[model samples]
Target chain A: MSILDYILGSRKKTANVAKDRLKLILAHEREEGGPDYLPALQEELLTVIAKYIPVDKNNIKVSMERKGDFEVLELNILFPDQH
Target chain B: MSILDYILGSRKKTANVAKDRLKLILAHEREEGGPDYLPALQEELLTVIAKYIPVDKNNIKVSMERKGDFEVLELNILFPDQH
Candidate 1:
């Protein structure tokens, strides 16, 4: 399929493509380090933060990006204001 | 300030905190790799894709994530339908 077709056609396939691409990039990134620790870190963060506030563990997103000279690890968590 | 305060305070400061946290995490990631080449890759991708279709260069985002045993490289580009 064409790039556009692949991007707009099946959502599952599109997601897979994105995931595959990210894997390659991350492999290169990890080479500079050893192994990814984000998963463990995310779990720890959730445990610690949930102790103080109600959070949606299922929706929490933790990722990383490179900006200029800095590498940025992004964290997004959803929690109800009333909770 | 408390974590909640930092998370909910001035937008600029909140952003700074997130950036700082990400920096620390990414520092560990980059230890596996020497240098990041994503910026260069993004530019090249823009040039190649722009040749085939009109796209918003400013909105294109290239990022990476680790999932299970795979590392995901995500590419997001916005283009007008008419173009």
Candidate 2:
């Protein structure tokens, strides 16, 4: 590839990264959580896992189905390769 | 302050920051948790709170005395000014 093509490709990548980050922020805000901070909690959790293993945030979901049992904190990050 | 004083003060601050961070890592590793990932869990949680306000990790502590009740997740960050 030409030098100009490489430069343009890198620029496109930066833009895409920014777009993806913004989209992620929006999605996190939009998601309804059992507690208001559940989304934040999950995001923070995924970061801790990232220190040990690479994970796809989109696929590795943390959901709480019922709150009766002292709150269910189900980290469905069992299948990292599913994504 | 003189330029040398300013520079020296800043250098000392940096050293303290590094020292504090290393001490934290060591403490986290040294502490025992029912689940091995408890330290990681707490650190990740504090980061979420930091998005909105400044926090002193040293002041805030997250600990679970007993885990018999569907796993207790206690976030002791209710007091931000304790530090």
Candidate 3:
């Protein structure tokens, strides 16, 4: 192991810890939102958008955030200068 | 303003701060990793994969973490039961 690895722990172990923590955080988020809705909406939107122009899934983001009285669903897609 | 908003600051203001902080963090990360490479690879991979099956852009995460000797690029895509 390198000096950095010794100081910071193995990358795989750290990644696993991060992955587990992410699962817990996502579970909490799922409870706040519905379990499947965000993922479902993201998928459906990608399918619909892909038919017309080229879809860059990595740049396509769907997010739902709560305001005072209600919630808002926001979609963001980044298209390259050429595309 | 709600009590929570007063305590936590306005959501829009808080979001702006968070966004700015995130930009700084991403800038640092980009300096460590190549600036344009990771995002470009992520976009290209998403484009190719979207051609075949339905894609969940939100769940499709591409990350590169440096190991001791090398770096590993990881792509994670979530597919549900229904098509």
| Candidate topping lDDT | 1
lDDT of 2 by residue, B41-80 (tens): 5566467556744467655444443222112233433223
Q: Rank the candidates by DockQ, best first.
A: 3, 2, 1
Per-residue C-alpha lDDT of model 1 across residues A1-83, encoded as one tens digit per residue? 22222223323442432211211111111223333444454455445445544556565556655433333345544444341
Could you tally the backbone clashes for each prediction?
15, 0, 0
lDDT of 3 by residue, A1-83 (tens): 32222223423343332210100001101222223343444465456445533466676555555433323333444443331
Once superposed on the true structure, which residue ranges of model 2 sit more than 4 Å away at CA? A1-41, A54-59, A64-76, A79-83, B1-35, B56-61, B65-73, B79-83
Q: Put down candidate 3 lDDT per residue, B2-48, tens digits, no spaces.
A: 22222234234533311101000000011222223334444553565
Whichever of 1 and 2 has more DockQ, that candidate is 2
Better of 2 and 3 by lDDT: 3
The TM-score between candidate 3 and the true structure equals: 0.27
Each predicted complex: what DockQ?
0.03, 0.04, 0.05
Instruction: Work out the TM-score per prediction.
Output: 0.27, 0.33, 0.27
State how far residue B57 of model 1 sits from its true place (Å): 42
| Superposition error at B8 for model 2 (Å) | 51
